[model samples]
Target: MTLSFSPSRPAYLGVVRVSAWYDLVVTAGFATPWSYALLHGGLSSVGDALGLGVLPALDPIQTLYANLMGSVVVVWALLRLVRPLAVHGLFDGAARSLFAMWQAYALAHGAMKLLWVFLAVEVGFGLAQLLPWWPSRSNEVEPALQGR
Candidate 1:
């Protein structure tokens, strides 16, 4: 008897694509300054009814960082959406893993610490992209010889 196992690509790709679209939408928060209200009001807040993170100081550097990250997120999503099959899962996993690690490091160093929720989400996405491709002994098998 021989055992076989095959995982569905559509389910995994569906998760990847949906997550990418979610990234695009959520990333818009980083692209604009108005969304910074979540810093104080918590990441769940919808409006900037509270004070902005860039007010009395106009910290251009912080603004630049936010826009840059947002742009990268948009591009990343577009890539996965455009080339779901051709796009390598490992590449997406590695990129997101690095991004998540960097975000974790920044948080440890007290940079945008209030955005911990975002960090958690990033880590989740990274894992989601990786788990499907992660190597495992369970996936390996040796063929049996006939008439041995």
Candidate 2:
């Protein structure tokens, strides 16, 4: 149970890329207002069908926030997807941790149970990227810059 906080491990690059790909795939639909509207409708239908309450109709502010978040995430995802570095895993992991925290808070406050699906994925990816994939060795770890 030795935790390697070192993001300089080469193996971490794979984790970064995978996380980025997940973001791209999942959030792409939210990147634009039009697309988000469509996605919201689709999600609402799915939720209703599953007996989970539908997503609330997006107000202007909610739409704006969703679009902004999606845009930023898509760009960030593209960076790692194209040129993943070990350090990217560290930052992505941190971001996932924050997202999971907020999602949990929302769930606790009575947000959609469907969110649990997202939370699970977030936790999975966050832990995968944050945890040490291999045993740490001071003698073996590369310099931070070298990991780039």
Query: Whole-model Cα lDDT per candidate?
Result: 0.58, 0.81
Deviation in angstroms for 127 in model 2? 0.3
Question: Which pairs clash (backbone N, Cα, C closer than 3 Å) in model 1?
Answer: none
Q: Taking the tens digit of each residue's C-alpha lDDT, what string does model 2 give over 1-148?
A: 3334546655667778878888999999999999999999998888888877688878999999999999999999999988887767767878999999999999898887788899999999988876653345443345543663
Off by over 4 Å in 1: 1-8, 32-57, 86-88, 137-148
Q: Model 1 over residues 1-148: C-alpha lDDT tens digits? A: 2222212344656666877788888776676666643432444232233321212233667767777888787888888788664134446667778877887887676554445666687778677766654455223211100101
TM of each candidate vs. truth: 0.64, 0.86
**Which candidate should be chosen as best, given lDDT against the real structure?**
2
Candidate 2 TM-score versus the reference:
0.86
The TM-score, computed over Cα atoms with residue i paired to residue i, of candidate 1 is: 0.64
Candidate 2: stretches off by over 4 Å? 1-10, 133-142, 145-148
